[model samples]
Target: MEFKGAMGGIYRLTEWITRLAATNLLWVLCSSPFMFCLILKLLVMNQNLANESLQMNWAMAILAPLTLFPATSAMFTVVRKWVMGDTDTGVFRTFFKGYKENYKQSLIGGIFYTLLFVIMYVDYTVYMTQLSNLQIVGVIMLILIIILLVSMFNFFSMVAHYHMSIGQIMKNAVLLTLIRPFRVFSTMLGSAVVIFIGVKYPVLFLFFIGSVVAWFAFFNFYGTFLKMQDQMEKMKQKDEEQESVEDKKSDNLQK
Candidate 1:
């Protein structure tokens, strides 16, 4: 009986782990098609930045809406459903659902990120024109600010998928990052490692492999965080109910 109990526990643990991994894998697969769009958007943005004379034409204008909005919307659906423990939804369904629910938020978030990018560009351009003593410090501050903003923005966008109010989403995002620094740092480090490996090994489709691995890591980290959030909320509700019960009991005793 003891041996069977131990085996059962082990089996349950293994099953949980497997389910978590499978969820992440499904999200990664669903997100794969957006990779091309992401790359194109990056290329176009870079070109626009490098060549100031390029016309502010329709192509450049539509880049954010076309590539980022759809991709982000799809990601939101996959992540949200995964967080809700919906395993039956397949890759295509997740993508389509995400696109449908997150379209406006994604578009708005894209515009926000783009505006930040533009500000950074302007800051860099202004710095290039000056030879001040604080140039190095200014550049470093700008970079740090940009990184912080981007991280916060990403967290907000993810929270928005749950239809959270903007203020609540931002607050939750900031709190999560502050409280779960290890998870946030690990995500950043894992992404960096994947990119580095991809760049180092060019001949064997390393980029694709690395991207797949990174996506899995990111999905797992994000899903785990969402699960924890749910548990915390449940605990909070339970505590509130207990408090209410105690207050009612005290009132009855007084009466």
Candidate 2:
């Protein structure tokens, strides 16, 4: 039975909180090994075990493509449903369904992104540190790195929402990031806020951060996707009108 008045408002709010927390928990569980390595890396850093810290970093990198990326894509899938008004869907069923469908693509894309980040970071470090005269080059690299990070956000959103090949998704994600500056910055800003909150309240990661960020990212992505679709439709209609005008001209000439 549905509650009336304030009870209904509380019920709805509680329900959404439950959904977000549950999905975030599932994400953490799925990516547990990577998270473990990440935490261990932090501990190692605290102890000043430089060698072990480096080793843990490598371990995390290896596990990221295998676990974190697929889990994150699945999380994005769940949040995409919520953003698209399918809030009543089964969390477990939707999450795993997205995992199974998106695993290979997410893994491949993850590898590409991981390698790209490593290379760019190295370049940024060298230019900014060892080659002081090329600090300007490092600044450009830093900007590119940020763009890639934002593009990765778009990548997950696209992966969860679009049924395209990974190549096409990557191409479109980068294009969208570059072409739609406002949305790109909006996503980045929202994500930064989420990250900041999560860092402040580390416990939030256990229950809210991942899913919350995924929801906001896809919410932004879907809005942009709809606008792009509308623009494409208008362009197609304009082309059809032009074709019709040309046909009329041809008929007039034949007469």
Candidate 3:
């Protein structure tokens, strides 16, 4: 028993470490837009290349969706497979396969969400100077931003798991995110802490940040979805039973 327990613990540790390394490495390679522009900025920002730096920043910002869409979709796929105990699909292969498979949908999703966030930011900036009803617009925009980001966690998960249309995905994402508020809060908190750690200790960005945050967030989402599925099944069974009971009662009344 002691040996079996030790082996299990070690296996889990090794599995986690292996996944973290693989996920973060894939994340780095896939985030070329941000990394390349960051490197360019770092090299030129202090060299009096202000105009070029600005252009690089603009390119990075504009490329954000294109860069992140496929990668995030792929990451979510890899995470799902890992969590599902499907050891058959190799991590890198799974990520690339998902990236290719979901490329079009992810690109569209990325564009939509990116535009939504950008619009929110722009509107917030425009309204910051005003002290009128625009404040209400600003507040609404802020709320939308929160909802968008919160739903984003579930959106990627859903995209990985479902073959729904973009509109369907969006609607379900919003609903699922709202269905489990505590899950969203935990994911947000985990993400914030990850960002703080990455900023404070840049070395972690290379190996730990992305995978660690994603794994924890994915855990919460996976549990929420499973619980929801069970609850829905229960409700469905209850409805069926109630319908059967009503049918029987009607039959007796007719008799």
Top of the candidates by TM-score: 2
Better of 1 and 3 by TM-score: 3
TM-score of 1: 0.58
Candidate 2 residue pairs in clash (backbone atoms < 3 Å): none
By summed lDDT, the worst window of 10 consecutive residues in model 2 runs over 1-10
lDDT of 3 at 105: 83
Off by over 4 Å in 3: 1-8, 38-57, 130-133
Tens digit per residue, CA lDDT, model 3, 61-91: 6776787767878888888877777755688
Q: State the C-alpha lDDT per candidate.
A: 0.56, 0.93, 0.82
Write down the worst ten-residue block by lDDT for model 1: 203-212
TM per model? 0.58, 0.94, 0.86
The backbone clash count of each candidate, in order, is 0, 0, 0
Q: What is the lDDT of residue 87 in candidate 1?
A: 50
Best to worst by lDDT, what's the order? Answer: 2, 3, 1
Return whichever of 1 and 2 wins on TM-score: 2
TM-score, candidate 3, is 0.86
